[model samples]
Target: MPGCNNNSRLSAEEVQELKQICRYVRKMIINTVADAGCGHTGGSLSEVEILVGLYFRIMNIDPHNPSWQERDRFVLSKGHASPGYYSVLANRGYFYEGKLADFNAIDSMLQGHPCMVKTPGVDMSTGSLGQGLSAGIGMCLGRDKRGLDFKVYVLMGDGELQEGQIWEAAMYAGFHKLSGLIGIVDYNKVQLAGTVVETLDLEPLADKWKAFGWKVLECDGHDIGEVVDTIQKAKRMSESGPVVVIAKTIKGKGVSFMEGKFQWHAKAPSESERKLALEEIDSCVE
Candidate 1:
């Protein structure tokens, strides 16, 4: 986390600013996804607070020096959530915010999935479900072997837990006691096809992680304060092993009609619908 103020907590003003960033990022996601004509919308919208909490508040890193050796690494295992990821990186000054609308354009730097080689701030290229955690574990191990100090955070989708590779990586991290690796599951419960319960129930999910020998934390994913605080706790938690925070979220948060609806998972908004979604988001400002 080179050149970052590694503060353990946010002051009142900082918290308010972080909340504002989350709201703005939500609008950016709508605009970016709408401009793309088609993109993942529901999960992107749902993950707003968690990403904002990390980028704007918790993680330490220099946007200007994205390749800094000490920079914290992030892997979006649930890579379909690119709309949200791109919006954050753009707004954080990793690249031109205007160009975000060019997402998925042929040969554009911003494409359907994150590309570490193409994107300035992208730590790892990821889109394949269930693979990012394994990559993150390797990063943690790399840091240890190189005697470098930095954390690796992996954000995953709840439905992604069904991937065997995820468990395999979890088991490896647990056995090796990679304390610098943190896994965050966006437990929104809804996927492109249906609810997680109807699709693949991950009941006793936290316990499963515990069984894997990782520390477990759960919080309201949409609550900026809670998300930030929980992450800070994970950072300071005893170095017993890797930590996983199961963040409970809503698939389509903020947009009224789209909230919790699977149909909006990859649905692009019509011009009118985009405007309406923006207006709805504006009304929720507190």
Candidate 2:
């Protein structure tokens, strides 16, 4: 059993710092998509705060030693949006910022999907939909059986919920009483093809989780304060099976033209569009 005695909790100042990092991460996503000529900019932007809250405030990670036994685990099930995840990882000292320029480049560590073998901070190589929760459940169960108290956090796209496997994993987590596991659904309402509601609705999503015997909480994914608070609440409620935090976010949240539009899901920004995105993100900075 791995000792969970490490201090993973963040102070109020650290929360503020994480919020700032999220803003930079959003900018990095916009720029990376613009430079790469192809990427999931919308969904990536929508999950910035969630990633930030986890990496900086909630998860017990050591950038120096990513595979530390006592560290909490995070899996990005929506792996196409690796730009955002990579940005956060880099900002947290997993790698250098210069590495971001090689994103999606041939033979680069930054592939379109997260590759645990290639990236240093990535815990699991996830790209296929509906699999991350299962992996998270496995980690949670492993930790439990080992008498470890570290938590496992999994982030899923809303569209991914349409897959039957997601529900199965949810049920399994609840049935096993994997209280140390936490799943966050990025409910951006849009998928690659269209709005999640128009494609395959997962409405009354929170209720569905509750029905599975898991504690469910909802928050604004873009709001750093709310996201942090919701995660804290989930951590404290771990005694009652697993917990799911449904975060309502806007696809392409920071960019004006891209926000709320499904077109930006996997669209690369054109040269002019890149300039516009940079301008928009620059304005958001203090």
User: Which candidate should be chosen as best, given TM-score against the real structure?
Assistant: 1
Worst 10 residues of 1 by lDDT: 1-10
Overall lDDT per candidate, in order of appearance: 0.89, 0.86
Pairs clashing within candidate 1 = 1-70
- Pick by lDDT: which candidate is best? 1
Candidate 2 local lDDT, 91-187, one digit each (tens):
8889998898889999999999999999998999999999999999888878878888788889999999998999999988888787888899999
Q: Residue 179: error of model 2 in Å? A: 1.7
Residue 205 in candidate 1, Cα distance off native in Å: 0.5
lDDT of 1 by residue, 27-86 (tens): 999998888898999999989998888887667789988999988889998998999999
Model 1 off-target regions past 4 Å?
none
